[model samples]
Target: MLNPSHLHRLFLYGSILLSQVLPLAAQAETPEEIACYNDVQGKVAWNQKGTRTWGEDNARNLCKGVVQRAKRISCFEAGILSHNNWSKAISDCAQTGGEAITAIVPGKQCIYNRGGYALTVQWYNPGLIVFNGGDADDYSKYSTPGTPFRTEKIALGQTSCTDAANRAAVVRIIGQGFLNEGITIAVGTSVGIGTGVLGAIACVGTAGVGCPAAVAGVSVATAGAISAVGLALPEVKEIAYIGVPGSTNYLDFSGTAWNVGISNKVPLSQTRNFAKESAQTVASSIKDFVTGGTPGPRSITFNNQAGYVAEMVVIYQIYKDFGNGTIIPIPVTKSSGQISLGFSKHIDIPVEIANLPISVFINGVGTTKNQILGATVPANFSGNRCFKSFGTIFNPQSSNCN
Candidate 1:
């Protein structure tokens, strides 16, 4: 219905509008893509939904000279200079919507040395720029200063082996990991080895620089030697030595086997040794006195046996009521012996007592039950009073009738 000129003008306007609208509609469909471009300050173009989200070339363009700035800032921070310069650089990075330069990267160091910066800018990404070090294939062989030293365990034995072959074996075992290598050996003061012996033992094969010519058999002396050895072998950072106890002579070969790289000492207890004796003896005089019979000389025979010769003392206590209501403890007898182990000996212990209600207590080696050898004294002595004796390791029995 419109005129030709009006129609032509309308067509031209519609074409221009279509061109602008189509591009805007495509951008509107990918909001993240728009944000990525805006966030990286137009330096990086990103296709958020694509497999390659960011172009490496774009990242390189963004980080062109940032690595050099990061290195200079880091070195300044470590030095005695005022921290304001370093702080300003970090602030600038943050203001640019990039990560703050906190540490000097290894790649940055290489770039600085080569007088150029070839770092990829991941400012919009999560991490710092990393330039390849070119020696990646040999990285495994690089030992950092933080690497820990190796450890080895060695055991020293008891007993002195005077024989050359035996001494060699002992040395071989003691120097398990450090035979050709320089090492420190800590010896206890209790060790009987002399200074000459210790030096001769330590200084073998490749003697380390400043190795002690002699080491006194003392902990302090060994420590001094260790310091000297450490100075000699600069590669060997630290050496730990453990002293073993109960090592007698060079050949006694008795000690715990070393499993771990550290030392463990175990305590040994003393062995047990003791002796005992036992016997039964009739006390006719006391029995006769209790039964109101004629008193006669009462002979007592003790069947004693000893085991494990050890010095020991025996104690005997007799309680009696001598025609009085008050019962009194009487010192009957005391004996001591250097008793032989597993041997039986006969002994005679005679006692003369004039009492009705009586009780005898005997303790041997100062240890045993029924060391209270006799039965309890009767509450009231009306019939004959007699007892059978017994003995044990703690208590020994003797014959006594009085």
Candidate 2:
């Protein structure tokens, strides 16, 4: 019912509204675009130096292709490297699938060490790259071996830089000392003082105050220089020559001298001498007792029916009980492999006939037996009454004598 012009006006307004609404609906459906917007906003909130929100033109140009979009997401997700070192920055940029770009900036060179070696590193693109020297060559070659170069990958979402300048400075000082003393800085060679490049640097660095000459005696000779360097380091108690080739010659760090040669060792020698003297005394006494012949060797046999898994040790003791209530216990004799289940093994033991009113106690593995023999000479001997305890079973029985 509307006029043509009015209808055309209404259609134009509806088309404009639909056009605006369509883009938003499309954006809502595309999760990647929504994620990009969220990520961009978060980066802006964390606004570190050298980091900025990408402009519309710059974002469009940089985020061209599907691969480029993925790279963009990864770049934003990576942490910002804070230190202005060429090697570290290049490594950081490469981890996020980018190359480090450097530009020469005048009057920013930093000179370190007493040798006046000058180096410059300026972080111009945060995680992207850093400006170093006048051109970009391999940055890793410039780093010293002892320099505590951070090789650990930066954790995602970390934005702090580990300062390597302090550690590098200490290395340069130690390197200069070695060079002045005319000592070759061997990479893996074992110094006489048992210190290498990294160890020497750590020793001086941990001292907090400047390394003193007395701490690590940095002298002209290689041995003295290495020794001094080792002494200067913390946790080194004493340094003794262990007479081994290479760095294995260093003594243990027990704050005491460990003598390696036989010239000064006496403790072990004394122990051996004492053991020999004690053995001789025991052998002489046993010889005299057997030659006296007051009692000949008497044989005692033990028989068992429960087969032993292996040869078991048995100990026998003789105790004489007088009628006056005084009992004397003789020394026990130990014999191994003399007790068997199927066969009987005899043990020759010397016994005094005057000690005839004696009790014989036999114990082997888990079996114990006691036999009371009266004062009659080989006539009043009774059979053994044994109480056996093996594992969880206990059996008390009288022995059958043949």
Give the whole-model CA lDDT for all candidates, comma-separated. Answer: 0.26, 0.27
Off by over 4 Å in 1: 1-200, 203-210, 214-311, 322-402
Top candidate (TM-score): 2
- TM-score between model 1 and native: 0.16
Residue 117 in candidate 2 has what lDDT?
16
Q: Estimate, for each residue in 312-385, the C-alpha lDDT of model 2 and write its tens digit.
A: 23344466787699987654544435332233344444444334333333344443332211111241333322
Candidate 2, residue 125: how far the Cα is off, in Å = 34
State the lDDT at 121 in candidate 1. Answer: 9
In Å, residue 86's CA in model 1 sits off its true spot by: 45
Q: State every prediction's TM-score relative to the real structure.
A: 0.16, 0.17
